[model samples]
Target: MKSLTLPAVLATALFALISPAIAQYADGQDATPEQAQAYQDAQGCILVLKAAGGDDNLQMAEQAMAKAKELAPINGDDTDEKFAKSMKDWEEILGLASVDESKQFLANCRETWSA
Candidate 1:
């Protein structure tokens, strides 16, 4: 039998909860600004987790990233601009964060994203 990782299991559960709303966006319907912002924030958290560089964190980051992308693809529209801004903002935040702050942020992300 295949073993599921914690991140994978959590992501599956989270997706089950949110997939209906995400599906409408994924199916070429317009995503609201709030949805776009949430996607960008999730991407930023995924990036931060990946940067943290532990095996478990990396796995979680990958799982979260996959779900975020699936839910809100940037299709050269307004979301593209929001995504760019989010990356820049998150990069700055990452640079400014101390190790402890990063850890706390990661912990919060794991809770928020279920990853």
Candidate 2:
């Protein structure tokens, strides 16, 4: 997998600290930090898979992304800002990820997040 950029990693850390109270699963359970990170990774993986462009990968990536979001949806008033930041982070990840790395991310997402 590609290493996370410093800014993206920092933004994620900051968001976790600032919005701990607002972040929760669809079932109303508080999300652990690891769960939140997995969710973010799944989102990033989806972007990578989409850019790579294969029907099979896209289908699995979408399923993983959906499951990740269902388990840990971003909530509260700053939802738009949070999503914007996440998109930027995913873009950065996409830029650095090689085909093999991107495929690894997709695999990880399917294993960790897909239903």
TM-score of 1: 0.52
The window of 10 residues in a row where model 1 has the poorest summed lDDT is 1-10
- Residue-level lDDT of model 1, residues 48-105, one tens digit each, is 7788788877787887676566645542223757546545655665665667666666
Residue-wise lDDT of candidate 2 within 8-103, one digit each (tens)? 433444354335533554458666545665566556666766765677768877875674456444432136576657666567655665666655
lDDT of each: 0.57, 0.55
- lDDT of candidate 2? 0.55
Q: Which structure among the candidates has the greatest TM-score?
A: 2
Model 2 scores a TM of 0.53
The positional error of residue 20 in candidate 1, measured at the CA in angstroms, is: 24
Error of 2 at 99 (Å): 5.3
